[model samples]
Target chain A: MRAEALLLFFSFSIGIVTGDWNILSYTTKKRDHHQHHAGISLKNYCESWRINVELNNIRGFDVVPGECVGYIGKYMTSTQYKVDVQRAAEQTTLFLTNNFRLGADGKDAWIFDIDDTLLSTVPYFKKHQHGAVLGCRGATTNSTSMEQWMEERSAPAVEHMLDLYHEIRARGLKIFLISSRREHLRDATIDNLVKVGYLGWTDLILRCAEDCYHAVANYKTEKRRKLIEQGYHLWGIMGDQWCSLVGHPSANRTFKLPNPMKKAL
Target chain B: MRAEALLLFFSFSIGIVTGDWNILSYTTKKRDHHQHHAGISLKNYCESWRINVELNNIRGFDVVPGECVGYIGKYMTSTQYKVDVQRAAEQTTLFLTNNFRLGADGKDAWIFDIDDTLLSTVPYFKKHQHGAVLGCRGATTNSTSMEQWMEERSAPAVEHMLDLYHEIRARGLKIFLISSRREHLRDATIDNLVKVGYLGWTDLILRCAEDCYHAVANYKTEKRRKLIEQGYHLWGIMGDQWCSLVGHPSANRTFKLPNPMKKAL
Candidate 1:
């Protein structure tokens, strides 16, 4: 393995010093097609964009790039998406198996974000051009549309999250479902979560009318702060959005599910 | 655009429900050529692994997956890698251009992680099988070997980071480079930074001998805590490793550079 790796490294470095590397030929040939702006194929471009979004490098974009709409649509519905989310879930399970030492004091807790983490609203996003036309948190004008969709309570459990949720619960951790959904949507949220096999979570916290003005990160951060103040040791926070997982007084660990449909703040 | 996206979404959903979609044909064909595990192409698997690493989903990994060495070798040397980093740098530049109100006080500062964020240590890793063998932080018995390489001071500036560094400097924000390299290597580290077109910074902080026992995250977080205590308002922190960016008292914003070479804890 070392020999093979060293050979490739030398070839690459030599190619860099001299501009005659055939390894670059593949990308160059694809660039000539000109279907995309950069010579990168749609697959490579969208994948890189998704990585950037996941890394929290790309932020505050209201909509998905128009050029990547189809790519994102296909990716969200692809086997690769299922594999990615499952892998993240697997990592969480592995961490629990290997690292976490649960306290018997009953103060141990785990936080799970609702949208695109517990329940997937991809069906809604599918109609909205996969976050090209409208996203869940971007425009207040779309709030009515988003709430109506939530009220339908038909959103499916994200691919592997239900299993992971059950695993966390089985381990005797208190589960908190903190969401950016408004307080008025409480009934619909519970109904959807229950219908999708998420039962008996400790609390389902949502945004009150007063909490609506705060950014999702700040609201969630405040909720976590209150939880920590209540003497709960947050073992982990799981979410599809960076805003859900980042801020002061962060949990001991965080599990980020894959989401190309939307970036929530 | 919406029509195109809708067509793809419908096709994918229909395929998911009925189990017949031509879009899967491309991936299926690629999967047949399995020189790797999971029936997934080396490119796809390595890319996903790299994304998981960047997202902090994959943790405590000591080396690159053996099967992925070739794929990672090619990717690190590929135009795609350069484009990915350049795109991140563009986002930072765009952020500074639009938002970010700088204070007249020099206390408004930006923090940069030294290793892959500013200097490309790829040359050293290139000889180390691109981290299939010795990673910077994972194996400290490698200190002598790593220090000797650092002392050579021949490492190049990571593409685009030098420009971003200069941009932040021109904006008059005090810059701090907080690195995980031990204090013994400070002279070598400074030499490499200077030799690679990096000049002038508010401070170059390194881990002291007593600090070597602390994990990289804790050590850097402590450094950041001191900076914050000293009244330096951290405007942003940029790094390739999550350890350099995440934790309490984090900067107001963060920029994550793409680094598949190594994941430092």
Candidate 2:
């Protein structure tokens, strides 16, 4: 860190944010403990920054560009989430490696939920009520806020799922991004995925206008049924919410990514 | 709140444990985020205190008495763990309330792991390396140490699990305490349970000498099978480790309590 940035960081956290916020920068001097193998990640860095920002109601991170605004949505995931995600992913990979036979027809597929699964809305949620649902009537003064935020095209690929997506594709399996998002927002959603490094998905399926009134689980289960009827085998399904994974014709295996930010919609 | 205690805390964290250990005490001024609602629990209190204790490598908590040595073990569950555990329990309670038929046979049973499920080992593990397995060898020097601690019978009932246990038993069902601890410690273990307000357990099953050589899962699985064969309906099994919950004749449902402290031996 440059001297100026260091001084400003101290100023932002101690003087601007809260004097107690500097405690996060605290570490042990006992150099000999078992080192945490994964060093601090950009996601973790943003999470800490987001916590302080919310606590202080600060507009943005100090000394960083506005582009980093979207990064704060990677909030809520702390060190424990990182461990649990890795464990679940590894188990999925192992289960597939051991049990899922490659299809001779190349029709085997995996389903992934978009928000909080493949991408995050944490940055936007941090600016609003962190756990409030962004439904049509859920927000105040700006119902279009959700649409505007979506247009920012900045929901970053969730770290573990992004890696899992690549590995599934590498294994010559089909991957699909099925979301609860409205179909009209498809273009921006696609652009955001592309910008955020999500690619090679066999397809991106969004909810049609008629499906807006259904429960999220009902809409998602219907989508899963359609995929199966179309002759695609959902060898595995992964989502941060149960709405995406449960109900009839469930995948051969299902992985739930943790999202405790709110009551499930 | 004395200046002397504050100075001692900083010394223990920075000068004794880690030059950077103060990070664990970091909190925000907003004072009101989503208030974590199970309220201030003994384990929760110990966990926050333990984070600072380990980071600073300080043995005693400042402004708190010294004999709370065992309290150091409430170790490293993060904010996420609290959220996840509450969600799962709520889901379980909801599911049971909605679905399970009331059996007049009174033969239905619930299985609970003793440590970290019914009772917390957080206070013990907080002082030791969180992940260091408490193997027989690890216990000998600590063996007398373990015996001493058990005699203190200080292991408090885990807040959430105790609630669930009471609820299950209140419904005219059965609750069993199954643990990986040795048969020799049964007396103290029972004392701890009674003192901590745990009662009406159908049985407290501890590992005998013959079970010592088996993997924990194998031992637990075998015990579960015996219960099944003996005609008890294992409606639900709750545990902190997979070893206790997984493998054969699975319960109608399983509940996993989070314990990131160590890989179970």
Candidate 3:
């Protein structure tokens, strides 16, 4: 009896040790899988959706590659709606390039807003359930850490517009990218621009903490003023939001218009 | 008498051939000397001015380190001026870091204009002025032959700014480069930026043929709008021309002002 009891005790101890070791190994595998998934999933999604994918040999506008964060979420649910959005992007590039006589003499410029204009961050908001995904929350003002939430987020770029950008470049005009992303996201933003084939500006402007504005419209107006002062004549302006195009005198011209949707804003 | 005449003619013919050979060698030497002088004269003058000499490092915002171009003529008026520019650049970096709250976490962004803003193009322009200078005025408007002219042109950057750019980057806030240059200059521009310490942008906007505006202000405004759309609250913006600051609501903000001398319209 004594011998049997001793044997049983040893067996139990060995079982416990093995169990623990298995758990540890499982946890490590799980963590690594999560990391790989984050990177691959985002890239895969972008590729599949053809968002930011280059068409033909033309490269999009990007100052830096692989640094900017992109958040993908449903902007509209219906397939018909997506088609509409894509069409709007196509029309916008077309109207701006053709009607405005852009690219003549290489002095024309097109300005674009980043957030909803290029990609949507609504998915991040949905996933994290964080109100105002990119914005500061309550007492936690100016938190750059929020950008980390963008790691697994990305959406497809509007189709057919990359070719339009190429067409514009072929004509000798310029595309200017403007973003309100904090200085921290500069690298990521640039990466996305290049990836998307919108890379064609002589410069890029990002919002810093000091650029506090009463409203988004005011911020856009101020930006327009600066470009005019530099001797670039505005030919086209594009944005998902009205505030991006509002308040600038040039916006009144035919070249400036909201993303064409059947229901105008 | 006939034999004497034939001998004299033969001697005369040989002398003519030898004389032609000497003339050919002399012309080749003269051309080489002119080329050598063009390259060395710039170096010597820059050295005399106490300017930091770097030839290959002239990729981005840095000054090209030679006197072959009119840059040394236009800006390097004297050693005192060179020293003053260097000192001013150092002061600018200091001011940006300490007073402007620059850095990744800071609220200001220094937007640098590539051509004429940070780098001098006078040399490139002058070198391309050859045929035109020789009263071949029609060559200026002829596009087919412009490539030949461009082949001879060499634009050098401002070296001090290149150093300052790197220094500022080390300090942390983003450096947004805005230029009116064409897309073909991208590689050269990026090379220049890297050589001078501008690694890459969080965002880089370039002017392309597709944009609608001909004014820099229009391009700037678009950039500002995008920044706002990205949700970065900007603190400060900087550029060589006033138009670069346009559309930025913070233009009048105390921190947004460029150097007093640079603020001229």
Candidate 4:
């Protein structure tokens, strides 16, 4: 209540203050622990930044901010990250069970983005400074290293997603695994999926030669468009990237899993 | 490091474990205080839910989850929320000062949402159980109460947005305040804006009889469409709701301020 009062006080004060307006100073004032409230600490601020990133308000970033490396590291490895993923899975499954009605034609399908959505790439990210090096796009040493990492065929399945995969199959929904990973990695990717217990899926779609130059959103949209043309009803599309779920010809519902470590546009 | 290893261990273990899969159990395992991780507490889960909300992943929530009332309360009144707003404003200012070029024509305009974006209706929300009642759309006793609250003309300016408004004005770009508030409240709304130091803006567009039944997004989109028809170049649109920024004929950029109190879609 006191904090609310202080905020209101500050709000009116800023309105009345005559000089050069510095709005941040009023809200960010550091109160002592002995006083009513502590100010916004670096950890608190980074959490806010992460919220912004997840909100898709902050985009087209190559890497996490320099100061937020430790925060991001802790967040990725923390129980919070696990809980977030579980909640996303829960929501998707809840929507599927309660609202979605599969047609008799067997044309009902669900799109799953492979990396971060269906597979755990956090181990590789942990080794690479939690998105500092390997989270970016395009041809560089980072991309080459990422390719080698994919080639190892050792990435684990995203925890709840494997179960969700089985649930989708059991419900007779055709599972289409769409990934931004290039076509050349398809063999290794399949091996990785099989090893990780994603034994059967309708199709594993990867970026081919025709998709090389397009943005991730455009490429994914094209894939969905093709599915639409093929007489498939996309029931749900799940991914860690907004690009996976956005664009025209969207699914009946889209679920976004949390991945603060990387953003692809 | 231990957490990361434990997560990896769980990731692989889930794949190998054969029976009926309850995957959430694997990741959400609660450890002792003496052990490596404490697992996800209730507080942690609510935080994740909040993240999901901000991500636009969770939508159409009627009220803050009953268990999350306290968490949302602390978050709203905390320094963290203020810092989030500040960071949003900072990002907007950075984009404006660095990337945005004002045209010689007066048509280069910016759009601002009224409630939550320009003013703080938190006081009324606090009285109404932090959006338990008033956040819903349509005519009800809650709407009447909310109308009375607005008529008081006592709402405070959202801390950083007023400054952003001034900065936008100083840059010679036309400013349009487009709100979902009915036209009946225009006088009080204008009074509130003036009382809180938002002295000048190009126009204040409010909903009228024709817009009574339209979804907020559609209404705001129509306004933008009309602006475009009038040769307005919407360089930027800033709002607390996604509805304000989305839809056809979008601006060059859209900035979303953090607001967890209410969702109108």
Instruction: Compute the TM-score of each model's chain A versus the native chain A and list the values.
Output: 0.82, 0.68, 0.56, 0.82
Candidate 1 CA-lDDT value:
0.72
lDDT of each: 0.72, 0.57, 0.41, 0.72
Candidate 2 lDDT over residue span A132-215, tens digit each: 353311223343776789888889766556666777887888988888777878999999988867789899988768887777
Candidate numbers, best lDDT first, in rank order: 1, 4, 2, 3
* Candidates by TM-score, descending order: 1, 4, 2, 3
lDDT of 3 by residue, A1-265 (tens): 4323433543343334321110011111112432312222232222212111110000112211121122122213222223333334444554555566643456577776665456555344445432333321111232344466443335334433455455556666676776656566777777766665556567777666666443445656787888878777776676544445545555423222112110111
Quantify how close model 2 is to the true structure by its C-alpha RMSD in Å.
13.8
Model 2 fnat value: 0.08
Summing lDDT over every window of 10 consecutive residues in candidate 1 chain B, give the lowest-scoring window: B19-28
lDDT of 1 at B119: 85
Model 4 misplaced stretches (Cα beyond 4 Å):
A1-40, A132-140, B1-40, B132-141
- Top candidate when judged by DockQ against the true structure: 1
Q: What lDDT is reached at residue A260 by model 3?
A: 16
Per-prediction DockQ = 0.19, 0.10, 0.01, 0.18
RMSD of each: 11.4, 13.8, 29.6, 14.2
Q: How high a TM-score does candidate 4 get?
A: 0.81
> CA lDDT of A63 in candidate 3?
19
State the weakest 10-residue window (summed lDDT) of model 4 chain B: B18-27
lDDT over C-alpha atoms for residue B121 of model 2: 68
For model 2, the DockQ equals 0.10
In candidate 3, what are the lDDT values of residues B1-265, reduced to their tens digit?
A: 4324433543343334321110011111112442312222222323222111110001111222333233333333322222333434533554554555543545445556664445644344444431111010111243334334333334454535555556656666566775655455566667655554456566566666654234556666676677666654454454433345445454312111111111111
What TM-score, over all chains together, does every model reach?
0.81, 0.54, 0.32, 0.81
